[model samples]
Target: MLIALFQILDFLLRIVGWVIIGQVIISWLFAFNVLNASSSGVRGFAEALERITAPLYRPIRKILPDFGGIDFSPLVLLLLIQILRMLLGGLAVELTYSDA
Candidate 1:
């Protein structure tokens, strides 16, 4: 049961990590204005990215110290998601080994 739980968490963390990466790429395109704001595809991706990534960024953004006007929320969010993935993966491994 615990193993199953850990595996589930690991899977979810991986999915969230992928979404974050996608959001990061999409954000870069938007930042550079390479993707038109009026295009339906861009708009759809923008909305999905916002819906997925904003909650993770909100708290991190609040606590981040200013650095010459640059925002570090994305980096922080990435780090956190990666760390969660790692933790879940480790738990999954332990659970598997213990079950064996």
Candidate 2:
């Protein structure tokens, strides 16, 4: 039962990490003019990514100092996700040993 719960949480963290990566890639494409944001489909996809990631970035943005136009919030959030995953893994190990 505990392992199942840990697996679910790990899956969720992995999904969030992928979403962050996707948003970063999309932003890069837009910046380089590789993607046409003028098209409805592209615009909608970018907007959807933004909507999903904005909330995650908000608090991090508050704590991080601005670097002119460069945003590090996504990087910070990714690090946070990694840290949480590590903690979860440690807890799982500890719990499993306790049960044994």
Candidate 3:
């Protein structure tokens, strides 16, 4: 049961990490004019990504000092997610081995 819980948590963190990466890539594409924001599909996808990531990013943004136009919130978030995954993974391994 504990192993399963850890797996689910790890999976979720990974998904959120990918979403953050996707958001960054999409933003760069939009900035470079490779993606047309005027198009309905592109606009909708951007909005969806924003909606999904904004909640997670907002608090980090608040704590981070402004760096002109550069955003470091995603990097902070990914680091945090990685730390949590590592802690949880270690705990899960310890639990599995201790049961033997």
Name the candidate that leads on TM-score: 2
Model 1 earns a TM-score of 0.80
Worst 10 residues of 3 by lDDT: 41-50
Clashes of each: 0, 0, 0
How many angstroms is residue 78 displaced in model 1 relative to the true structure, after the best TM-score fit? 1.9
In model 1, the number of clashes is 0
For candidate 2, list the clashing residue pairs, or say none.
Answer: none
Give per-residue lDDT, candidate 3, residue 7: 99
lDDT tens digits by residue: candidate 1, 1-100: 8877877777887788788888888878988999988899889978988898898889997898779867688888778878887878887887789879
Query: What residue runs in model 3 are displaced by over 4 Å at the alpha carbon?
Result: none
TM-score-sorted candidate list, best first: 2, 3, 1
Model 2 deviation from native, Cα RMSD in Å: 0.5
Task: Indicate the residue-level lDDT of 53 in model 2.
Answer: 99
Tell me how far the alpha carbon of residue 41 in candidate 1 is from the true structure, in angstroms, after superposition. 2.7
What lDDT does the true structure give each of the candidates? 0.83, 0.97, 0.96
Can you tell me which runs of candidate 1 are displaced by over 4 Å?
93-100
